[model samples]
Target chain A: MKRFFLSDLLAGLLFSLLGFYILFEIAYFPVDEGNIPGPRYWPRLIALGLILFGLWLAGSKIYSRRMTAIKPNLHHPHQRQVLTILVMTIFYILLWSLFGFFIPTVLFLLGTMFVLFPFQPKQKVRGSIRISIYSLLIALFVYGSFYLGLHVPLN
Target chain B: MDAILQAFVSLFQISNLLMLLAGVFLGMLIGALPGLTATMGVAIFTPLTFFAPPEQGLCLLLGIYTAAMFGGAISAILINTPGTPAAIATTLDGYPMAKKGEAGLALGLSALGSAGGGLFSVLVLALIAFPMARFALQFGPAEFFSLAVFGLSMMIAVSGGSIMKGLLLGLLGLFLATIGIDPIHGFNRFTFGIKELVGGVSFIPILVGLFGMSEVLNRILEGSLQDKVLRSKLGRVFPTKAEIKRVTPAFWLSSVIGVIVGVIPAAGGDIASLISWEQAKRFSKKKEEFGKGSMEGLVAAETANNAVIGGEMATMLTLGIPGDAVTAILIGSLMMWGLKPGPLLFQDHIDLVYQIIAILTVATLFSLVISLYRIQTLGKWILKLPDYILNPLVLLLCLVGSYAINNSLFDVWIMFGFGVLGFVFRKLKFPLGPIVLGLILGSMAEANLRRFLILADGNWFQFVFHPIALTLFVLSSLALLSSFKKAPSL
Candidate 1:
């Protein structure tokens, strides 16, 4: 079975590639003007730093890996749960942008509570309604205090 | 001086006093809650200061900052869960002490140590702030650039592991800083046709996302296995005369270390507490008691973390550079309120400076009294709060906090992006602290470097002639190499 690149060496290699891409982008930047170091000069130096450090990270990591061949634990037991939360967060943001702050926040909070604390199999309805009410109260309290009282203009 | 008297008068106002006490209460409560850090508390509540007088706002925020440091010790002692990052060191001895049925005594020592260390740092701040500000007033761009370099080098010591990885992230941060309009030339550098990027990345979103939302995500994945409190019933919190005599010197020594660490830009309580705990072990005759519930170790952690508040306040109030992320947000909030912090602040807002010192003092005393007499009740309340509820609330706070900064959804999107970045970085075993430090100091470093280059007329090697800059470079190199030696093997 093939595994995703999840080790320090891989992360280092990816970062180094990013450094090279940044340097390549600097070619499009304007050059030195009026004897001053141009717009790209500082970025160039930083890019060099990124490249050097990234190489060091990858090189050192690879050197270490040769000494000890260990598997990168890519999958946690709750990988699906984590994915669900991340997706829920994305949807929550979309809802907030599309349908103003309060509605989305309430729904998001309610949804997150469920995602976080799944309803018990025996008392699913009671747990769901109880959690929903708690979310609503919290939503109102936070919104009223920050939005209404402090006039944060969340909408 | 008249300003001092006037400051004294204003600080004693009933309204200001109430707010100061309220800030302490809120700080303590939030600090005692696992997954709710002092940084998150300040970042979330900073916007509320918009409606209050600057003095009141300062009181509330400063109160929270100081009290939160102490508040974390409560949970550390009771539940073995550090409510805030600063309390991590405390859990070593504090929780063991609680397990031995000395919860009340542990809380008492922690409270007194916190108040004492806080007071000592405040005195250090009072003595050093003006002198430091005056010295800072002489800084040219070259010196400032070297200073930023020195600060960046601190990532080696601060990253907690992998110096190379820390430097890589720091360099990345410096690169990210270059994304907005070039400070000197006024030309857009890397906006990439996005309007929001022109102002540079909004730090509020990054801060809230990395500290707040990512933490929530981590908790969501932890799946609600909660920590149980072993001892809810607390006894009297006062130390005996013999015990006080034994721990007093360590408290003073740790407080000194705390102040020094706190004054350095980007350093914070976690480092100070950890260092002080080690130092306490070295200095103690009872060194064998270190991880086995030593009262001295608990004192060292509590006192040192509290002491950081004073040093942090000095750094923020004088240098316009923050000691940590919380102080960075504090500096931002100050700018939001039309108050600029620097040497000029010390001279022009003399009364406000004095007022801040007063606030620190009062907040410390209030936290001490509350922690001593009320810790039993507070500990129970803290244990009652569930992590699952906190997870969702923190996410909501992160969402609202990011949105509240400029009332922009773009910022919220940025928050979302940084949350993923933070979570991924944590997963990849990279230090998240340096990224924030890099982001905050990035523009400052770039601006100073460019300005210094222009001033030196591109004879860049001439930077070594400047004594301060040269010293800093030397120190930075030393720090970098030292951190490399300290980096653990893979």
Candidate 2:
């Protein structure tokens, strides 16, 4: 299946199911006198509309067979980088919980920069050092504005 | 006239003026950065304004809102990646300009166009806000319902290649909106017994996940690192007198389209930019230059996006109805200041409203100055930071930002869950904006529909026959029909 069609079909089905679930619940939960359409009426109607829409999408996709071509070049390759970043994020969150705001932010900035931007073929060492310094300064400014200047309670 | 003069006096107060400048500068800085959007910038800074007087605080946020839209153009010009969703159209021409070594020209045009758009919309807001608010105050539940439906119809027009997908997402968003406490009855609907889910999903967390986290995940999967190239030294960044004359028509045209679209509840800068870009293309003298470094295309996109800031605010201040997500947050901020926004606000606090309008105008001028003087150096420095270092730090900020919203760890988890969901949806090529729109408008749509049905004794034809509702319904149907004609198979 073309990814777009499949995604749309799944989303439509999900909504339709949710709508049915809401409708089923409304049977037990009675609406009071002041309420006009009751709790269930609008949701159930919207749900019905969704199910029909979903079915139409699925049927059309099957009949047309005009799936979007997935381009291979669009996929990201740096899985390890992303995983590393996620791990660092977890560490920072924990550090914030334990040590407070300023410390963890500084550490994350330094640690991630070190791991990610090792010397490339065209990169100059001097330029890299300069960038590291500039990054540190920017990080400090960000921390100062949010934590100290704004006086946000970190702990 | 005296009220307007008093408003200008308040706006020109040294402190308020300083805050406006600072707000615009900060907005431009944050907006130009990838992964940081206008909504996030506003949300994060909202708490900071707690210390300031209400007008000053509002002025600051308003400045940030306007400048951020313009700031997005910086990244669109220098990098293929748009700093905000509003800049997506800008990249069609801007990136082309940068690639052809006209980065300065592209940035310059964007700044000029943005200022013009902002100024034009502010004028519109000044002229029409009072009358519009009075008109909106006449709206009953049925009318509100019709408006919401009309707004939802734009989604069909917005579905670039797939109306089915757009509808599906819109439905899904509506479903998600049902997860919280029932608006009228105070009964829980779809919380599934989770206390955290009772407040409904935080829009910010979901937005952060969909835009910020999804981008990170996509980058991870695409592992091809962005090539870092030094900005090419080029000709004068300022447009020549002739170049200005060439783009003047597009600027005015886009500004008008942007303000009109922005006035509609739920439609925002992204829609405005897209619509304006299409219109500009339709009317351009050099239509073939589009997507190939055409200055007119860049001007239209930038102008419309910035213009929306003023137009959106006009509705928010006048009618308590936000035109987009950023303005929705601003509504929350306004409520925090104990200012009840709506038609009565104009009657009760006309001076404050005028001051806000004045501040918006001044802030746009400040944004122009800051962008012209500092953007080149700032853009270069920002783009120089490696993604590895920057992405992790931003993730940490996201976690903290979500946690800080309500001081609940549950929000953190929600942010992560939405992030993962956003990544998966992005992989499936689903557009994220419509879903957010659906969530925002879903409750309003549901509540009003229910009320209207009850008022009409459960007659659905009432929606079809009422003049305002009928007009809105027809317009919405036409928007959907146009989309279908453009892409019939989907």
Candidate 3:
């Protein structure tokens, strides 16, 4: 099942499903005006393409999987780290909208960097201070350049 | 001649020159980082150009485009990581040469090859662009539609894994592009009542997200967040007279190949370098050393990739069709500056076109001079920077840059959504380039298609009567058929 998930079969199925949905949705758009292609014509053509190619991908992948006996190795060491960072970023964006830029941005930067950095028990204090300072400086720079210089309203 | 003189005069302005230098320096830095691409470098820095005049902005972007192509070689030699996708071929011989303790020599050869190739392609552009623009000006609606079809057919070449997957993604991009107001009719379609959707999905946000934020995520997932690169010593940087003579044939062959591929829509530096490297290998007497540590191979790859910049610019400037993803963004930038690229550009803004030529030439020379002086030290320093620090910084820029476009958090959200999609797409081995091309060309194709139909009065067969349209359609078919052949290995 894991091997199947890693294959193009899943992608094909998903795309084909999306294609059907698009086909259904574009039905609401008005039909072509005589010869001139209306709004629906282009999308209808694209949706049909999606269906055709999506089926092709899935069919090809399935055939290849049957022909071959080897299973793909899908191990990833940093899955947890990646997921954690993604979730953290969501929170960071939320905080950014509600509380404004500096504090949330500085914390997000410092926290992400710390999470990414290799662990060292003895150097934790030093590393923490350095990361904090770097985060603060980065935040300030982005704030100054984007907010102050370019006049982008961060608040 | 007077326009050329005025171009040079404008180019030498203190602010323009300074921006060009800064863009070159920044491009090099961005290109030296593994996983960050030339497209990403251009996209991330695009917002900065919004503040400047068209000339200065173009200079800045062109500097980045030219320098980044060369900059990828730095990591390829030192860390065995091709900093940009274009440098994938560079790693074939670059890493091996570095291992043999000739890192400096490899770097020097790469810089020389890059500058030589870039200059050759620029010469071709100067000779060909005006004529090409004149020819393209003759195209009617049918011919234009067929040309767009031809451009979209290139999806197969850029499709990394499978042609089917590429076509599907291309369709998806086309669908996404149709969300805004219809080009022919005034009716709104697929907006779902969201005000932001009426203007269509913002190109920059999607671009930055797909190339930037998704890259950060992918790096994290790959556990390459803290790269432990083994440092290589920089030895003698300059090549000997005999060595230069040995590589002369490769330089010529690769540059020609580079320009040809670069002129084709959707075919970029990565494809150009791979093809050039293969061709050089076929011609080289020392073919056995082609992938081991051959100077010819390194020079071929670097030269071909840089040469692509000129050919890409030629197509973009003359036909208003992007040659690759980076040029696609550049087209958007040009549009933002209220300048339409095509035959009329030659008639109306010939001075600007001349300035572009001058910028490309000067940028090549400047990058070479800098590479000769200090690229070795710069490469070493870049290799030492940890991804932990770099990734976060990039994410910050992605967030801010996306928001800066419309001064709305909505664009940022759109970027985040696309970033997630980009990551998922990558995991599925889908090509992102097709999506970009599809998005960029969708409206043009759709609009022209309808116009051609109207002009022909409901007779679709009239398309076959137009010689240029028929030729383009034939070429598109051939390109699609050629996709069945085995692609060059990365």
Candidate 4:
């Protein structure tokens, strides 16, 4: 089995790549027009800072890892649950944009509640009914406040 | 004295009193909801005030401003989320205190501290507004740049155990601030071909995502649903005599910090609260307990944030300069009423100034009474809600709040993205506070530095010659240097 310190290394790598990308993009920015420094100055300074700090973070982590032989815990018990919620939320947003606010919000709320609710094998029907009513109420309350009262046009 | 008497009498009108009460109630609701800020509340109601008489209108707006600052502490204490950005520092000790079965006491103390700070700032406004406004006007581009540098140095203090990771995120926030058109040349830098990016990132969405949505995500990942019992425990609402005695000095000190920071144009409650929290920690006997639920830290944050309203009012009324976003909207509203705000207007409308002071005092007192009355009931109600139901509701609010900011789905997407980003940062042990600090001070730092450079003909060294700027630079260096000794190792 292969193992590595994913958290620190990944963060360092992510930031370093972002820094390089920003540096690349800002190259096209107009240079100093006169005595005043141009748009590139501030961004350039920050981009350089990102690069330096990213390397420092990664370098420090590597040094620390060499000194300590500790195994990192990478797996979470509820990874599947977290994934389901994230995917469901994405669908909720998509449905929201397509079909407006009411139906999507109710569906999203119901789905999340079902996933999050404590499992009792004997009371599935009751749990479903309770979650359905709660979801409907929340959606309606949200709709009334945002769409009717505040006039947010929740489309 | 006669004008003060007349002003107090004017507040007794049935219509005026109703408007004040309504504003206070509405402001509490707005402030307790995450993403709905005091600025938004004031901006939304500004138009309504145009139809009312001067005294009544001022009363309503001032009531909202006063109560909203206090209201933010409600959500911060109850949940780990801050209702408003001004309450960011409140989450440091407030949430811990809530989790420790002192939710009631936290809310009560927050309300009292907020009222105390509000009253103190109002006194300052009444007695020394002219001098304070004059001092605020002395902050030119160079001075503002220096102040922002000092503000950025606080990122080191807030970085928690990992200063390197904190500074990295802070730099990233600064980079994000440069996405819009350049401040001086009007040249687009990093819009990435999106028209919405021209406005740069909206801070409210970022804030909601980072603090509110991320919290929900973290709870879910921790399998909070499996726990049958809610964690928060309702306890005593009021502080004991000894507790009050311990926190009184913090209240006074932070109130002064809040007023000074508030009087500075472009600085607001958020910055004041942060500085107050740090300074309180430095001076406290319980320094180690600061982030772990120190009463002094909580009192300092709440008091400072609420106190900012008075200093902002003073600056707006005396110098025609807005101290923050809410005050900027207030200035526009006053102009709509044909009430010019500068020295000449004060001489011409001394009676109106007296009336404003009267309105502010009453509003502070009214807010305190309402907050104290509701603290226990609100804390109990929130603690009663289950994690499954409450987490979903919080997520919904986060979505709605982010969307409500610009009526743009892009902002919603930004919120979702940052929520995920914040969750990752949390998992990776990076401190979130410095990122926020960077975002808040970034543009101010960049724009003022450029302006100062232009003023000095690119002579950067000339900045040190200014006494205030020099002093701020020295303070910033000292703060950053101190971080090395204070920050814990990974």
Number of the predicted model whose DockQ against the real structure is largest: 3
Pairs of colliding residues, candidate 1: none
| Candidate 4 displacement at residue A30 in angstroms | 1.8
Listed in order, the DockQ scores are 0.53, 0.40, 0.58, 0.43
Query: lDDT of model 1 at residue B396?
Result: 78
lDDT of 2 by residue, B1-490 (tens): 8877788787888988888887887788767776668876776566557557888888788888888887888878887778788898999999998888889889889999999999999999999998888887777777777766666667545646677767767777777777778777777776779888887877666666665566666655554334744457734589999999999888989999999988876677878888999899999989999999999999999999988877887877775666776776676577557777777788887777888888888888888987888777867766665666556555656666666666666666777677777777776656565676677667878888877777888777776657877787788888888888887456
lDDT of 3 by residue, A74-131 (tens): 3544776777788888898899999998899999999898888776989998888888
Q: Candidate 3 — what's its lDDT?
A: 0.85
Tell me the tens digit of each residue's lDDT in model 4 across B1-490. 7878898898989988988998887778667755556765665565456557888888888888888888888778877767678999999999889888888888889999999999999888888876754565667888878866775665555446677787788888788778888888899878879999997877666766776677677777776422222245567878999999999989989999999988765568998999999999998888999999889999999999988878878867775655665665566567657787765556677888888888889888998998888766654443345666766776787787677656778877888898888877887778776676577568878998998888898888898689999998898788767776776653
Clashing pairs in 3: none
Model 4 Cα displacement at B359 (Å)? 8.5
Show pairs that collide, candidate 2: A75-B222, A76-B221, A76-B222, A76-B223, A77-B221, A77-B222, A77-B223, A78-B223
Residue-wise C-alpha lDDT for candidate 3, range B67-138, written one tens digit per residue: 888889988888888889999999999989988999999999999999999999999999989999999889
lDDT of 4 by residue, A40-138 (tens): 888888888888888877777777664333343436546655667778888888898899888999999999888788769999999899999999999
Would you list the rank order by DockQ, best first?
3, 1, 4, 2
DockQ preference between candidates 1 and 3, better one: 3
In model 4, where do residues sit more than 4 Å from their true spots?
A: A1-6, A66-80, B1-114, B121-130, B222-367, B371-376
> Candidate 1 lDDT, tens digit per residue, B1-490?
5765677688789989888988999899889877678987887677667578899999998989898998999888888889899999999999999888788899999999999999999999989998999998888888888887887787546667778778878877777788888888777877889998997877667777887777777666655535476645677788999999999988998999999999987678999999999999999999999988999999999999999988988988887777887887788678778888877898788888998888888899999999988888887886677765777887777877788778888888888888888887877678877776677678888888888888788778979888998998998898888877876742
Question: Relative to the unseen true structure, what is the Cα RMSD of model 4?
Answer: 7.2
